[model samples]
Target: MFSYCADPSVLDGWWWFSCFLTSATHLDFYRAFGAVIALLLVTAPAALAMGMAGAMMLRSQIRPLSMLGRFYVNIVRGVPDIVFFLFVPIALGQGIEYLLHLVNCPDWDQPVRQGNDFLVCRDAKMPPVDAPAWVRNLYAFAMAILAFALVFGAFVANTLHGAMQAVPHAQIETAESYGMTRKQAFRRIVLPQMWLVALPGLSNIWQILIKATPLLFLLGIQDVVYWARELGAQKTSLYSYPHPDWRMWYFSILLVFYLLLTWASERGFSWLTRRLSHGQATAEGERLRRATA
Candidate 1:
C-alpha cells in the first residue's frame, strides 16, 4: 500500500516485509480472519439454541418427542463429524430445492434423481444461475452455519441433558412445594442450576467449535486456512512479490491465532463461570464468597 511498494523488485528489508504484508493476497488473508470470527459468533448461539431445544425434547414427557430427541442426540453423536460436515449441506440444499421444485414446477414430470445427477428446474435452483457472487457466497455460508449448528448442537444437547439431570431432584420438589408447576420449577430452579453444571462442557464445546472453523475450507468457503495456503505458497520471479515456501510460517501464524483464540475463550469462560457461580452452593461460589469476605 505504501508508495515505495510500487516496485517490489527494488524493495528490501522492512520495506519488502511491509509490501509483502500489504499485498492484495495478504490483505485477503487478513479478511479471512474476520470470516473465522464471524462463523464462531453466528454458529455458537445458533448451535446453543438448537441444543437447548434438543435437551428440552430429551426431557419431554411425550414419548414421541423424547424418542425424536434421543434419535437426534444419538445419531449425531455416533456419526463422524466430518461425515456430517460433508453430507448435511448437500442434503439440506437438495431438500430445499426439491421442496421448491414441487411448488414452482409442479407440472414438470422429470424425476429429480436421474441416475447419477440430482436435477432441479431452473426456477428452483438455489440463488439461481444468474445470481451475483455475493449471493452464492451467502448461500454457502448459511449452509455452513447450519452444518456447524447441527453437529455442535447434538454435543451440546448431550451436555445439557446431563446437566439438567444433575440438578437436585429436591430443588424441583421445593419449587413444587411452593405451588409451582413442573414447568415453573424447571424454569426457576432446574434451568438456572443446570448452567453451573454445564458450563465446563459447554466451554470445551466452544473450544472445539473454534478449532472446527477451519473445516469451512472443506465446505468451499475460502476461510483463513484456504487463504493461508494460497498466500503462503512459493512464488517465482514472474510474480511481483515472489517468495520461497512459506506454508510453515503461514500455518504458524494460524497456530498462534488459534492459541490466542483458545486463551481468550478460556479467560472469558472462567469469568462467566465465576459470574454464574455467584450465590450458588458450588465450590466456586463458596470460594468467591470467601474471597469477597
Candidate 2:
C-alpha cells in the first residue's frame, strides 16, 4: 500500500480499494481458507482410520466386537449429523476437563455437577485458562476434526463393510484350500479388493465432505464461509471504505471454490479407480484387460 493509503478519507478509486482489501481483517479472511484446508487434510485420514476400525470390528468373528460395531455404525449413521456437530465437541471437551479435574483437584470439596453447570478447576480448561488465541483456536479445530471423524466414519464403515462382504466366498475358499487362515486370506486378498470396491462410495463421501467444510462456521471456526459473510456485509459511510453489500460476490467466489474442489476430487478418484482396477476381476478391470488385448 502507498503512503497515500494513510489518509483513506481523501483516497478514492484504486488507492482506496487497495488498502481496503489488504486490511488486517481481510488478511484474516484470506487465512480462513487455510483453516478449511487444514480441517480437510486432518479429518479425512482420521475418519478413514475410524472407519477401518469399525469395519474390522463389524467383520470380527467375536460376537461382542461385531455387535458393538453394528451398534456404532448403525447408531451414528441413524443420528442427524447436526446433532453430533452440536454435541460431540462440547461433550468431549467437558468429559476431558472432568477427568483432568478428578486427577488435579482430588482434595477439593466441590461437586463438579452442581445444578446444570459442569465446573472444573481453572487448570482443567482445554488449552489452559491463560492460553493465547492461536492455542485456543487450535484446540477448537482439533475438536471439530474429532466431531467430523465420528459422524463421517460411520458412513465409511458401512461402505467398507458392504464392500468386504461383497468379496466372493469362492476366493476365500480357494485361499483356505491353499492352507491360508481366514486372517491371512483377509489381509492378502479381501482388504485390497475392499478398497477397490469401496472406492466409489468413498469418493462420494469425499465430495460430501468437501461441501460440508462450510459447516465449520457452525462449529465457531472462522472458516471461509464465515469470513465471506463477515467481510462481504455492508460497510456504511461511518467506515473508512464504504461499500454496498458484496455478499453475493463473496458467496459467488465460494461457489467457484467448491465447484473446483468437486471437479478435482472427481478427477483424482477416477484416476485412483483406474489405477486400482488393473489386473483385477472387477468389471472395470476386466474392461481394461479386454482393451489391452
Candidate 3:
C-alpha cells in the first residue's frame, strides 16, 4: 500500500487496487484459503481411518460384521455426495438432541415431532443456547468434517478392499507353506503389498478431498468460499473502497488458490510414489532398477 492510501480520494492508478485488495474482508478472504487447507488436513486422515475400519469389517469372517460393513460402503456409494452432505448433519444433529432430551427430561411427555418441526428442550440444544460464537462455528465445522469423512470413507473402503484382493495368490500361498494362519499371512504378505496398489487410488481420493473442501461453505462453515463470496459481492459506494461486480475476480483468486493446493499435493504424491516404490516387486520398482543400472 502507498502512503497516499491514508487519503482515499487521492488514490489513483495501482494504489487504489492495492488498497482494495488489502482490505480487512480481503484479509479474511486470504485466511479462508488456509481454512480450506485445514479442512483437508483433518478430513483426509479421518476418512482413511474410517475406511480402514470399514474394510476390515467387510473382510471379517463374522457374517453380521461383514454385512454391516458392506452395507455402509454400498449405501454411501449409491447416494450422491451433495445429498449426504446436506442430510447427514441435520440427521445427526436431531438424533443427538433427541437422545439428550430422553436422558435429561425423561418425565416430560412432550412429543419431539409435531408435524414439520423437531423440538428439544433448551437444555438439549447442542453447544447449548448460550454458547460462544466460536463454539457454534466449531460444531458446524465438526459436522461438515464428519459428513465429508463418511462420504469419502466409503470410496476409500472400496479401493482398499480391492487392493487387498489384488495381492498375489502365490504370495499368500507361499506364506501358507510356512504354516502361517490366515491372519498371519494377511498381516505379513497381503496387508503390506496392498499399499503399493492402493496408493494411486488413495492419491486420487486425496485430490477429491481437496476439491470437496469448498463444500464446507454449504454447511455454514466460514471457509474460503464463504469469505470469497462475502468479500467479492458488490460493495456499496459508502465503503472506503467501493467496487462493482468484483465477484468474478475474487473467485478467480480462489481458483488459483485451489490450483496451487492441488499442484503441491501432486508433487508430494509423486515423491511419495517414488519413495514407496523402491525395492518393491511392482513395475515402478523394476523401472527404478533399470534406471539405476
Give per-residue CA lDDT, model 3, range 1-293, as digits (tens): 44556766667678888887787777777777777778888999999999999999989999999999999999999988899999999999999999999988888787999898898888899979999998998899898889999999999998999899899999899999999999999999998889889999999999988888888888878888777777778777644576777779878988898899899999999998898899898899999989999
Reference-based lDDT, residue 132, model 3 = 98
Candidate 1 per-residue lDDT over residues 1-293, each given as its tens digit: 77888878888898899988998878889999998999999999999999999999999999999999999999998989999998999999999999999999999998999999999999999978899999999999999999999999999999999999999998888889999999899999998789989999999999999999999999998889898888888888744588889999999999999999999999999999999999999888999999999
Q: Candidate 2, residues 32-84: lDDT per residue as tens digits?
A: 87777788899899999999999999999899999999999989888888898
RMSD in Å for candidate 2, one decimal?
1.7
**Order the candidates by TM-score, highest first — what do you get?**
1, 2, 3
**Winner of 1 and 2 under lDDT:** 1
Rank order by lDDT, top first?
A: 1, 2, 3
| Model 2 error, position 140 (Å) | 0.2
| Cα RMSD, each candidate | 1.2, 1.7, 2.0
**Model 2: pairs clashing at backbone N, Cα or C within 3 Å:** none
Summed over model 3, clashes come to 0
Off by over 4 Å in 3: 1-7
* Model 2: ten consecutive residues of lowest lDDT: 1-10
